[model samples]
Target: MKGVSLAPGDYIHFKSQVPLHKIPIGTKQWRYYDFGPKVVSPLICLPGIAGTADIYYKQIMSLSMKGYRVISVDIPQVWNHQEWIQSFEKFLDVINVHHIHLYGTSLGGFLAQLFAQHRPRRVKSLILSNAFLETRSFAAAMPWAPIVGWSPSFLLKRYVLTGIRDGPHEPFIADSVDFVVSQVETLSRDDLASRLTLTVDTATVEPLLLSDSFITIMDTNNYSAIPQQLKDQLSERYPGARRAYLKTGGDFPFLSRPDEVNLHLQLHLRQVGVEARPDLVQSIPKGGTGGSPSKESDKKKDPDDQPKDNGGNPESTSEESQLPPSSEIHSLDDQLLSDARICSMGHEDAIILMQSQYTVVNRILQSACELFIFSLLPIYVESSYVTSNNVWKFRQLM
Candidate 1:
């Protein structure tokens, strides 16, 4: 699991592609987590915007237990929904999955609808949870998406604990927020902006707006407002198809109201002769493995854990400065400032003066450190990861 490999059951695991084999897919590589029985069964669980394969961890495990083959696709950064769905379709071919049970949430749900419409034969049944038929709502909110991405890392904690409300269908909203925040923390301001722009540019609206399709769009809305003409067309296209509108407040029905959503799905699957196994659904207890870190713990600092403090004032304490060692001073002055670059102040004095103004010098150094440190350590390790033992490594040398 640590690296990419194929197990006996044909499970493909790739942490990262090697230099020779890797092909960049926008900002992120396409990954697939395959699970369940070797024979035919529910074969895919696609997720939505800002979503990663990890989001469907529980679903993959649960469905695998139920003897269903499941593959959650990691979406690449794409400018349009058509391109996004096209890439997903190619991936499906690569995986060689002939038949699929399409399950998607939010944007993923929209993509699922598109996929089924394009290749109805390949899709056995379609399941969309807490999603919209059109992305106008998301496109309208595009400007704010960058703010969410660039906001301080701690914002996730506030949003999860109180800012975001839990719905009956999506119980994992809080956990999902934490995971997304972790991803956002790693993004650069420009990277996030570009991604948002791409999302808005690539959103697919026409296909979803179609009145005739065998797809079901699920959400808290009871579907009462859908135009009767469109509803009639839908019934005519897939006579057995039905719309399920579970009343859940949160956007993530999979997390907050998985039971309710699952129940509805089970009922529909039964109608189509597919059995439901509640026991096969995975349930993660609160504060269980990979749960959100406690607020108090996040703020607390351990004595052993200290970030590299690059602001020590050795020059401020004259006692700590070595004697003028004329030979050393002459050598330093020569290297410090070449004749063409000499400022109004003499090179030797300027050298001493810069060090003397430790306050300003340290401030400048700290700012540079904050900006460049992320490049060196892309993982965004917490302060806890830094320790006093290696503090010297991060110290700004004067």
Candidate 2:
């Protein structure tokens, strides 16, 4: 796909009442392509750090093929955070879409979460792949490089490339790096400075990176580095919400594993009852859980351990139900805790623990009790014994 280049002030606040034909987004009118399918939902794709709206061309096309109304924006070099929000609002207004399913990557994922947090009603569902939920890691990972260029391409592909090189989109990063390195050979210092400014201006968090942003980054990193507790936090934050883990790493999974990303998106949209193209089925990967536990969960168990329900399921064991006996829980629990790296006091401890009478209800209750111990010991409890909301909810169910 050819790139779409726009000057700094080229298309800000531009409006087109009718969907413009396959025109350039910046050359003249604000272009909007009509892939001409009765899309199940309108989608907005945002780029990551130093990414142009054009970088997602393959994604936009792939999604369009699946009957989606897709909009890929040309992010202004330096945009006011509020104005960007308004730009999204205006896009929805022009497109006459009340709600949208958003798929954001990296910085775009960060921004998408912010948008959903602030405007929950407008977001139908969100899929954030290889994105930073916080900025601390980003700051820690990439200390400031001198602003030596004007175009975003040079610095993004050169200086920032290292941070995302091992990311999900290794192929894209490789090609991008080659292109930028070649472009850098001939770029003047002033041009480099301009590109640095463009990159920084586009990627910088509005109103400065706040403590919340840092917390999100920390939590997201924790999600990978410490899977068990992070999954617990996510479950707490979005109760009854559906979530999944994609096998790829870094950011930009959409670019690296477009079909996988697309499959996840399709599944999520379906779960929410949103309209989507059925052709998405072919894009799904085999042997992957549609939305079930990944094998990472299976490896984290104590071998001799008894099953701990942890209030997850409560199916009774009986001839009619044919539910597996106590052995099943012990086996599954091991998988659930594998990535957690938190031991269940070892196999002997699990064996001793499992010797007692077992029932689905009892297993769930015991699991809740264990989680309560881990979660509420530090918090103040003036009037009640439990301080954490998650524990309280579990107690209610128990």
Top-scoring candidate (TM-score): 1
TM-score for each of the candidates: 0.48, 0.45
Question: What C-alpha lDDT, on a 0 to 100 scale, does residue 270 get in candidate 1?
Answer: 54
* Regions of candidate 2 where Cα sits further than 4 Å from its true position: 1-39, 136-157, 166-241, 277-398
List candidate 1 stretches off by more than 4 Å: 1-28, 140-176, 179-198, 202-216, 221-241, 245-249, 273-398
- Over 275-306, each residue of candidate 1 has an lDDT whose tens digit, in order, gives 43333223322111111112333343421132
lDDT against true structure, model 1: 0.44
| lDDT per residue (tens digit) for residues 1-398 in model 2 | 11111111101111111122222222222223322122245566765554555445445544444434455653433233454466556545433345676766655666776677666677766665544434443334434643333335544546644443333334533444343333234444443343344333434233222112112221122123222442354344444444556554234444434455555555555655655443432332222111111234334342113221111111111111111112221222342243123112234443344344334557899999999886775564632554467688998999
Model 1 clash count equals: 16
Each model's C-alpha lDDT? 0.44, 0.41
Q: Say which candidate scores most in lDDT.
A: 1
